[model samples]
Target: MKKKAFKEILKYVRVIVFFAVITILVEAVNYVMVQPGYARYIIHTVDNPDDGSDYDCIVVGASHGRASIDPHYFLEMEYAVNPINMCIQGATVIDNYYMIREACNNNDVKKIILELDYQYWNKNLKRDSDFGDLLVYGQLPFTSLKMEYIVSQLMDKDFRTIYFRRYAFAKNWKTAKKYMAIKKTDEYKNFQIEGVAGIETEGPYQGLGFFYRTKVTDKKGKLNPSPWTYDDLNPKVQKYFQKIVKYCKDNGIELICVTTPIPPSSVVSGAANEADTYFKQICDENNVRYIDGNLIKNEILNVSDDDFSDWEGHMNGELAEQFSEILTEILMKEDNSEYFYSGYDECIEAIKVRGNETKVLKYIRAAVFIAVIAGLVKCIDFAMMPSGYIRYIIHAAGNPGTEEGYDCIILGASHGRSSINPKHMIKSGYAKNPLSLCIPGESVVNSYYILKEACRNNAVKKVVLEMDYQYWTNDEARDSEFGDLFEYVQLPMSKVKLEYIRDELIDKDFRTVYFKKLAYTSDFSKVKYNIKTKLTKEYRDYDISAVKVCDANGPYMGRGFFYRENNNDHKCDFLVQEWTEDDISRKVIKYFQKIVDYCKDNHIEMVCITEPITPTAVVKGPSRDANTFFKDICSNNNVRYIDFTLLKNDVFDITDNDFCDWEGHMYGEAAERFSGIMSEVLANGNEEYFYDSYKAKIDEIERKKS
Candidate 1:
């Protein structure tokens, strides 16, 4: 009996072991099959159509890099250089060091152009922590050590959807069906460049002149460049920067550091000078070559702020092409031996021939292969997944629909999205039909195309653009999700836009996109879904009474309602304050003019209004100054301007406590009161040109309110 029991126990143990092995094998197979394609997508996406390598020269930094360099111009000169811009908005030197390291490992990068701007060395611990260091690693083995980030990448719907859909088995069935619905017209398949340059037109820069500003410094408390120092430079960060240089030198890769030209604003603050000094010192110590474009006043002065979409110091695509031509001439004369690649020229020629012939076939084959795999996968799990949610998500995320009909489309940075209330305008009668075609953190270059696409729908009548102060300053923030907006736009620019975009927007590294997706993917659900719901709830019960209003003199002293002022400076934190009088005035005028031009050209009526603020916090300074500037802009443009800074007594009482978040925006009861005021404005018939049937909608809304 004992022998029989022992034998049975051994048999059970064997069964358990066999099941474990089978599970591991199945998981391994799935991972191996899916991973290679995803990796390939990340690697191949950055390859230049002319040559299958990383960009010939990459610009790595923060916002300066994004605004400064253009890649197409380099391509136009036949320099065999592609600029893979890997700059992150608000990025630090530490962030760049890792990005450069990872990019080198993943691609056959030949040269690196580091944008040594003053801000790059400003290492804010909070900013670094928020940006994280994982984005730099790309597909290197050490990346997985950050397991939390890896899990986040796995959960990101955008990253996963984009990655999987590109795979042979996970293509979106509806998208595939739509493609099939459109009958092919050409007998011969058109060879198209998928890696870059989707459609080409005249570059946007051509005859459009550039405007330059002189850097001025004031003796008062304010400095031209607010803060300019490498105070944030610590030992570890400097070590990493040095490591990048050393790695390139040992690996036979040429490292070229270029300080992109600065605007007068930065020059006034002495930031440009400080940045140049630091880069020079680094290059001297490391035996690397450094190009100081910021120091070249004559060259920089020749190109104005108009040459840049952002009006910051950086050049736009057109200027970038010119700058590249200058740099190419210099480099060619200085040192041809450094750039000599063994068999690279021949390889490039061969790639051009093959790329031209197989471009269309490659895309078609990829699509068909993905379709077959998707069919097989569907057969395996047809009953488990729901289809509508994906489509709903796509639509909610601003996928353009077949229906059209929009007048006075708004475009800009996050300010446009956060400040404008579309529903309020619709109910108030200010607009017959208006669409807020704005996304959070969108730049001017990116907005240009989105506006173009909307206009192409033939439903859009006019465009209203909102500008942010940072958009015209060196402090502009970068979006890691889109890599560099400038670079992405350059690939799609008309021939005119292309000249500058290609020369300036393109960068050296393509792997940064994949790495960024991996790093940010971990919190994909939180970023894409949770914030919307949270923002809605937090704004639901904002109390205006809790807010404190101040003017140029400080807090109000009179008997009009007042809130207690806090001793701490947190009131200014994340609150939009005009840093200087000039920042507020210039930005308002610039964008207001753009709006007027768009409306006049499109034959649409335009209205400019300052949305209501909490009564207790309607103080002066930047915010109030901005409102005043808007009034001036409307007067100049012949557009009707409305200021609702002070709410009416009988309609609805709004106190400072009614604000949902901080002083910058209002919500809860305040939103309702503001919405009521909007309704009144629409009923007044002042905006008759916007809609023919506006009276009916106003009547219906007033009736509902009653």
Candidate 2:
């Protein structure tokens, strides 16, 4: 009887083990068959090719660095150093450290530029700790580690999801199959590798949705820290950060910490200061070379906070160009020769070709893995289906649009569009016929689609691009609603433009909302008061004010003023500020070159014009420098550059009240006088070139008025 009972128990155990094995096998198979689109959230596709040795100096920071640094500018400066801006949005010090580690591990990087802003450190500690630490450990475990970090890693659902998706038996099987298929093809083997690094690194899916929210005392009150202070982060995070420093030191990779620029308002809030202190302390303790651009108050503070996208703290593209140049100067001055790569051009080419192959394989594997996962999930759901119950999961994915047209399209931040008027040329007869497509507060990435559409339709003659100082000074917004503009307009994502989109557009809004929430906590009262105050202030003051009109014939109402005198006699201030002229000139030239290239490719002519500013405003000290930069840019572009900076002589007879409501913009009477001056310039063509049709058009308009 005892033998029979034991046999029964053994038989039951064997049955249970069989079922477990079957379950595991089925799961593995399912993971292997899923499509990559389904699993993209777990694995981000790197759109920009990573030529193994592409970057000698890699910049890692929060949004501040993203907008403030331009690698192309550095390249133009003849520096072999190609900067890979790995500034993620909402990135904290911990996150930055990990990103640096990951970048160092993947590439033969020498110098790491970490933009240290005060906000990075001043924020609640708990809010600062995020998946960046986990990613750092995952990529370079030997460099940075903590047992508590490991525990936190396990607890993070998103982190688990990414890792599991990568290594699951089913996922791996799918990846393997996809790789095999690509291995069979040689077409993608010889892809042309352009050495130009893009602004965006990964696809739209790279970012984990994290947002931070801090409690304010009242709706109108500034950001307060009391509520967030209580949420202390896990102490183990520091240990992990230290480990990263040690790893870099051990690997002989120079760790350079940088703090990207922030707007004055953000700086005044004390966050920028805190971040500087934090990074300074960390770098000092570790003996790492740290550069804090965020603390460079005068240069950075000049940019207005409103210029930032959605009021999030980051500089826009215009600012990035300037900042990148500054960073290049610093690097050059430092003479860290050990960190510079002499054979960067050769490395870029080789990496480009190799990177394409790697990318194709990666995509194929991702597709297969996702398909397998989807299939398994569907099967399980079907098998477990119950009456009147269903599961639905919807995924939104695809290219936002195309990149093809437009010789030139002006991409401006809030104030950029307000500065230039396409109508001025049309009415003045400078352009017999012209199309102006301008978007306000449009990031460089957002303009991709608009330009693409213009290219496709042959609608753009030449782009009159405007760069706000803020555009290049901050991180790209991740979920910018403006991406909808591309989709709605039907912009094509060409290979070249796609590169720009990834580099410039992808990481906008880098901080995932999840991380932001963790960093900020609030009481109901504080939240209410803050909301109320913000709403009232926004409603009362943020919108456009009513337009004021001046009589054109009376008191020179239509004439526009210039902020400075044209001493060069080149009709602009190109020669006045030669010291900082290169900085501004380089950006304008590059921008126009892009336009010129597009035009040359499509047989279109391009011209650039500088709109008029109030002379009183320009001559009054610092404002004169505005035209100094503008004039230099126009001179370098070789386009028909016009500076109304000295137009004050023509408009001096006009009263200040008639010409401008504020110092810059023309209201009622001033607009009309400026329009008339523009008409004469168009008709005469200044002996450089004759526009008969423009003169004819002006005559027709004048006749109609009579």
TM-score of each: 0.34, 0.33
lDDT, each prediction: 0.47, 0.43
Q: TM-score of predicted model 2?
A: 0.33
Q: Report the number of clashing residue pairs per model.
A: 60, 98
Q: lDDT score of model 2? A: 0.43
- Candidate 1: Cα lDDT at 670: 50
| Predicted candidate 2 versus true structure: per-residue lDDT over 448-560, tens digit per residue | 44455455544455554544333332232412434323232222345644555454434333222111221122344444443343345432342111111122112211111
| Model 1 per-residue lDDT tens digits across residues 107-181 | 677877777765545554444442243333232244533343346433443443322232322245554433332
Q: What is the lDDT of residue 618 in candidate 1?
A: 44
Alpha-carbon RMSD, candidate 1: 23.5
